[model samples]
Target: MYELKTKENDSSVIEFIEAVENPKKREDAYKLLDIFTETSGYPAKMWGPSIIGFGKYHYKYPTGHEGDAPLVGFSPRKAKISLYFATGDTKREELLQNLGKHTSGKACVYINKIADIDVDVVKALITQSIEFLKETYPDQPE
Candidate 1:
């Protein structure tokens, strides 16, 4: 069986943030912690080693691979902060268009810092991601 390495764990989110080598990134991590927590109304939990996640959902693929994932999350990476959000929402790109300076992969949005992106827009994206995930995986327990 394949192991899910990124499962949520009992790790301390604050300790992880404080360990970030970059002082500025560490500070931004706290800012994001507040943003995600307040926006999702869920306490932040450590996902894997560095991802600070809020809320969660379980998903099963057609191939039968299944696991739980954060409904919204972000990580303060070495190069840039990676904001995790649900893909496939039409409003995603629309909001990103106004989200200040940032780059997007399929699921992660990379930003230099919280100051580089609009905090309000980030909150909006978090809201949309949670709603989309709730609807997409309606069977997930609260």
Candidate 2:
């Protein structure tokens, strides 16, 4: 279990967003903040060191690993924004096709800039990812 150090609260989110030095990156971060808040209908909170997360879920795996994590979140790295989503679901491939310029790992989407991707497509991806996590981790609390 990855223990989140930051409390789930508004001050944390504000402080984290304020730390972004680049104006363009800061603006992108704010845009993401809006998208996540609206999509999840959950207040934004800071998760750990840098993740701006929305909502919460309690997850327990078959191997006995269990903990709470945000339903959706992103970290604005120096080079790109790392967007996280639950992996191992097949349905997300369709959304990826329309996400514009992005790279993917097992469960992360890397966007160099918000302008590089279609905002609507990214929003849909967030929605689908949240749904996928809920379905796969059914015991998780919304």
Model 1 lDDT per residue over 3-64, tens place: 99998999999999999999999999999999899999999999998888999999999999
**Per-residue lDDT value at 20 in model 2:** 96
Pick out the ten consecutive residues of candidate 2 with the lowest summed lDDT. 1-10
Best by lDDT: 1
- The candidate that wins on TM-score is 1
lDDT of the structure predicted as candidate 2: 0.82
Instruction: Assess each prediction's global lDDT (C-alpha) against the native.
Output: 0.93, 0.82
Score residue 90 of candidate 1 by CA lDDT: 94
lDDT of 2 by residue, 9-76 (tens): 55577778889998898889999999988988888887777888887777787887777778788989
TM-score of 2: 0.88
> In model 1, which runs have C-alpha deviations exceeding 4 angstroms?
none
Task: Give TM-scores for every candidate, taking all chains together and pairing residue i with residue i.
Answer: 0.97, 0.88
Worst 10 residues of 1 by lDDT: 133-142
